[model samples]
Target: MTWVVLTGRQNHLDQAATPHKVITNRDYLAHPALFRGQRPKVINLSNSYAYQSRGYYASLLASSRGHRVIPTVETMIDLSERKLYEHALPELELALNKCRKDLGGSFPAKAHVFFGIGPSKAWDRFAKLLFDWFRAPALEVSILDSGEWASIRKIGFCPLGRMSEEDKKRFLDAMDVYTAREWRDSKARTPARYTFATLVDPHEELPPSEIASLRHWARIAEKMGVEVEPITKKDLARLANYDALFIRETTTISNHTYRFARRAQQEGMPVIDDPLSMIRCTNKVYLNELMTANKVPVPPTVMIAGPADFELAAETLGFPLVLKIPDSSFSRGVKKCSTFAELKTLASEWMEESDLLIAQKFIPTDYDWRIGVLGGQPLFAIHYLMAKKHWQIVHHKASGKPDQGGIKTFTLKETPPHVVETAVKAARCIGDGLYGVDLKETKDGIFVIEVNDNPNLDHGCEDTGEKDEVWVRLTQWFLDRLERQGR
Candidate 1:
């Protein structure tokens, strides 16, 4: 991508030693030459980004033209309103309080951030975090130190001309470091047509996709001219740099994965397991109600809120029922009760953690069918057998380890059409993202258990049926969307 710097005046452009092109905002807005070629990464350094100002329009138009720009129009509007940015204060304040003594100066401290670089090394991490949240090229922040902790008082964009001589030198140096890359050179730009971010947590005990599987997907994508980069929670600030996002980690509404999905949608980037899917899939209570209202075939289930509802659930769903926490995953936070006393005890205890719980009639099947659906079609199918002699697919041990059941993979054609169709129906209710719909086949009928947003696609497991074809389809899903967006 090309780099262009837009400033308010010609003299302001003269101050920078950047190798990239620099022009006045007027020239960028009106010059036909600037508008004709490939869209560049715009560094909007105009004097003021106030609403409807020249600087504001520069960033706004850059976005509309498919150019990557710093301090996006969303960022500009966020800085304009305290209510818009206040939600980010708690996290930023926590970072500030961690290094309070290192802040040095006085009660009120002012810090300048130039492209995620702070005025001093001590403030670099905090500055990077602030930049990740706001995504502005330059920021001026005021921190007020209380007796117990420090709080953010104000945060706003810093114009290029308002800086002191020393700050200007630091700013220029930071800019040089930020842009001094081989890719920054037009002749040496990256060959890949698009960039993709795969979010993963190396430390997660049970990641949805194994590192090898992720590598396989990346290799396939790279061969097709898409660059795949693995990112973690710390890379949230760099999310906008990617053309698409694939969340390989387990998703929850309370975690960074949801934040990443939300940010990706806001930036108009294609993302798997979108925020709405995460919200709808992670909570069993929501899924239960959604499936019931849609007339989806699910085992008889009851939503238990308080102890008063336990008797009703037991009468309706029966004694040997499964109790589930709303946001549970990986067979955790699920309980099986055999009698009325056990049901009351378990439901009462689980109710403390969540306001609502799912009580479903126990369907004793040797194995549960896991139908993997992608874009409203069956991608793969598996028989998740019970763990040893246990009734659940995974049994938690007293030693704090889990004993998982064996899996039998089958192709789409080999699986029962009704099973695949029901899974697809359940998945579409969540959205067209990838899903793993668990179902149980009994004497009566096949019943939908739950849908997982972040289903396991581990190598040597779910890929056993289609092998490399699965990865190809997954990659194509992203590429097809990118092509539609004219990427």
Candidate 2:
């Protein structure tokens, strides 16, 4: 959660976290554990991506310890230069064309580009400003090439070369012109001491235990010397006021919860249901891919791409299989097709929205293990019994809220080691934030059904044995992050 800028030159304003010499400019590359131990969050804007560059190692070393890094190593090495030409060039071109339309056909031969080489948290906006500033063809925008001539341009740029005093002044002045006062690296400061926002929907019809969990969180956070307040979607602008945002409302890729998570992330606020966690946990198809890649046990599954694949899936997965729309949650948008006819009908319906449908072998079980994982550890475990006469915890067939079943809680010590370990491993593949890994204890073996980001953390349910310690453990993570981040 701490912020610092990594550059090949002398540090200027990135001060939230103490600046250290980049490997390229450093006398030596310190041990990776130095960063692994400190675990400070970093913004990688170092000019070099060559193998041993500080930018590359800073990202590699810090992220390996679960430290947060913006312009992640994946974005830095894989997506920045080489991938930019492939993925971003098209959009850049379109932005230029739009600019040209506004400029009456004469696209400027030169334009300022912010290379995400600073400590500004408004990198997304800066990327936008470049496109917005130049509506003309972007291909014509000439960056500084080999020629050396008298030039002074005020704009957001990564200074990798020795700049004359006048040029340096222009660059510094442009930093002020482009970056907002609060966003400027010079204005960066330690995060709020302890102001935390729990994103919730007051209007939502939450269960009593769910409501109790929130109250318990607030009470626990207060005792920890942290101020916790409930903020709704309407309080988006105020998200900046918090050191962390814990989302209690259900997370959907298309909903306000996603926006809150994203906003919190962009502002460098420690947040649960991190946009990556939410995105990875919400969809079944993606989960299948992730689980398979990691060799985690899963129900025999196949992604339905077309009519031909449907039959292949039915043949392989067999009849009475479970069909799920990628984004379905809480047992909704899931169907059991007993025959090919039913499978065809259900697949048609699901495929209308999702390009692909996931079909899995239906392994009957009395209950499923809902392992609550936080910060890459198992916090709590529960047995989610199926609704009467149904195959899942929430039975969609039986009217409002669907028929439900009893909940049984267990401490991590009480649960099977394999279940807890497998669940944690599965969730870690998605990124360590918070997750409820659903696993089926079957005759063959325990198999991960899916991982839920916004898993149920209701009072008296998930908090069965640990009680307030559940909230304590969860909140302590944020506190630690705030500490590590210099909050």
lDDT of each: 0.84, 0.67
Error of 1 at 389 (Å): 3.0
Q: Which digits, one per residue and each the tens of the lDDT, describe model 1 over residues 1-487? A: 3578899998885734777889988888876466454656688999999999999998888877777788788899999977999999999888767655675634347888888888677776688788888888789998777668778889999988998888888888877765543212233334556667889899998789988788777667666666677888877887897788999898998989999999999888899989999999999988988998998899898888888888998899886899999999989998899999998888878878799988899899999999988888788888999999899998998998899999998988889999988899999899988899999988898899999999999878998887888888888888888789886
What TM-score does candidate 2 reach? 0.62
| Clash pairs detected, candidate 2 | 2-485, 96-136, 99-135, 99-136, 100-135, 100-136
Q: How well does model 1 score by local distance difference test?
A: 0.84
lDDT of 2 by residue, 1-487 (tens): 2334455655533333233323332411465554433334444555555566665676676556555554455544433344333544455444445443344444333543433111223223334534332211011134222232212122222433444454445444533332222211233243323667888776675422265567667666666766566676755644654578899888898998998899889878899989998888888888999999999999999889877888998889987999989897788888889999999988887777888998999999899999988888889999999989888888765446567788988887899999999999998898878888999987799899999988888878888967788989988999888788764
Tell me how many residue pairs clash in candidate 1: 0
Lowest lDDT 10-mer window, candidate 1? Answer: 181-190
